[model samples]
Target: IQMLPMLVVVCLIPTVLSHAIPTGDKQQLQWISKTEALHTLETAVRNDKINCVVCSTIVQGIRQLIEEEQVEEEIDEFLNKACVTLDLAAPYICEALINEYAVEIYFVLERVIFTPDELCGIFVD
Candidate 1:
C-alpha cells in the first residue's frame, strides 16, 4: 500500500546512517546500546549527505537483524515510536500501516537476501 514506502524508509534509516556517519561517530556508536545506536543513526540520516555507503550499511544492518530473528518485536516497537515521534502520519494511520504491512515487509526482507551494497547501489545511485 501507499504506506509501504514509508515503512521501508523507516526500516532502512539506521542502516544508511551507519555508513554515512564519520569514523569518530561510528566509534562513539560502538559503545551505545542498540536502541541508542539506532536513534543516533536515525538522527544522522536526517542530514543531507546520504550516499551509497550509507545505503549499503543500512541494508546490511537490516538483513543481519532479520536473519538473527531479533527484528520482529523491536521493529514493531521502534516503528510505532518512530511514527509518533517523527509525526510522519496520524497515529491511527501509522498503527494501521504497521499492522497491515509488517508481515509483507518481513517476508520481503527475509526472502530477498540481496547484498547490502547491491541493494543500496540500486537505491542510492
Candidate 2:
C-alpha cells in the first residue's frame, strides 16, 4: 500500500512539472500585447468626457493611493473620504448609474477607475 501511494505520487510529478513550466515567448508576447492595450485604454479613460470633477479627483486619489502602496486601512479611509467629498458634490450620479445599469455598472466603474489588472481584463474581454 505504501508503494502504491509512492507510485501515484511519482505519476503525478510529471503532470505537475509540465504545468509548472515558465511562460514561453508566445505567452510573454501575448501578455505584453495585452498590457499595451490596457495602457491605451487607461489613457483614453483619463481623457474621457464622462469624468466629472469630483469623480476625476477620486479616481486620481485612488490611482495615487495604489501607486504609493498604502496600507489597506489607509486605502479604505482615503476611499471613504473621497466618497464623502463626492457626496457633497453630486450625490445622485452614482445612484443614477446603479439604478439604471445595476450589475453592468461594474464594467463602467472599472473603466472609470482604470486599475491595471481590471483594465487588462476589460480590454481582454
Candidate 3:
C-alpha cells in the first residue's frame, strides 16, 4: 500500500531508539528551573502533548514550596487551580486511572495558608 512507508517511518523511530536506550531514561523525571517550569505550564495548558509526567514534575515543585512554607500566598492558589484539577481518568480502549489522583486532596490541606479557628463536626443529636 502507498501509506505503508509513512507509517513505518513514524513507528520505526521510537521502536528502534526505545530498544537502544534504557527504559529508565524515558521514565526519569528531569527537574526544570522555576522560570522554565512556569513556561512549561503556559505551554502545557494548551498543548496536546502534555502528559502525567510533565504535569507531575511541575506539581512536585509546587508541593515542595508548600511544604517549605516559603511562598505562602502565591503558591497555594496556583496549586489549587492547576495541580488539583488533573484528570487521570484513563486512556482509549481502557478508561482506567493509571496516574494516582491525589494532588487536589493534598493541595487542599497543604496550600490553604490558614484555616478557620472553629472546626465543624457533624453530630446526630
Best by lDDT: 1
- Give all TM-scores, in the order shown: 0.58, 0.26, 0.34
* lDDT of candidate 1 over 15-117, digit per residue (tens): 3222222222434643324455555545655553446665555565666566567657677666666666655568787777777877787778678857667
Consecutive 10-residue window with the lowest summed lDDT within model 2: 9-18
Q: Where in model 1 is the C-alpha error above 4 Å?
A: 1-40, 44-51
Model 3 agreement with the true structure over 10-82: per-residue lDDT tens digits: 1111111111211123378454344554455446544534444443343344335445554433433333233
Residue pairs whose backbone atoms clash in candidate 2: none
- How far does residue 105 in candidate 3 sit from its true spot (Å)? 3.5
Off by over 4 Å in 3: 1-31, 77-104, 107-125
- Residue 79 of model 3 has an lDDT of 31
Question: Candidate 2: global Cα-lDDT?
Answer: 0.31
Q: Worst lDDT window (10 residues) for model 3?
A: 116-125
Candidate whose TM-score is highest: 1
Please say which candidate is ahead in TM-score: 1 or 3.
1
- Rank list by TM-score: 1, 3, 2
How displaced is residue 30 in candidate 2, in Å? 37
Query: What is the lDDT for 48 in model 3?
Result: 38
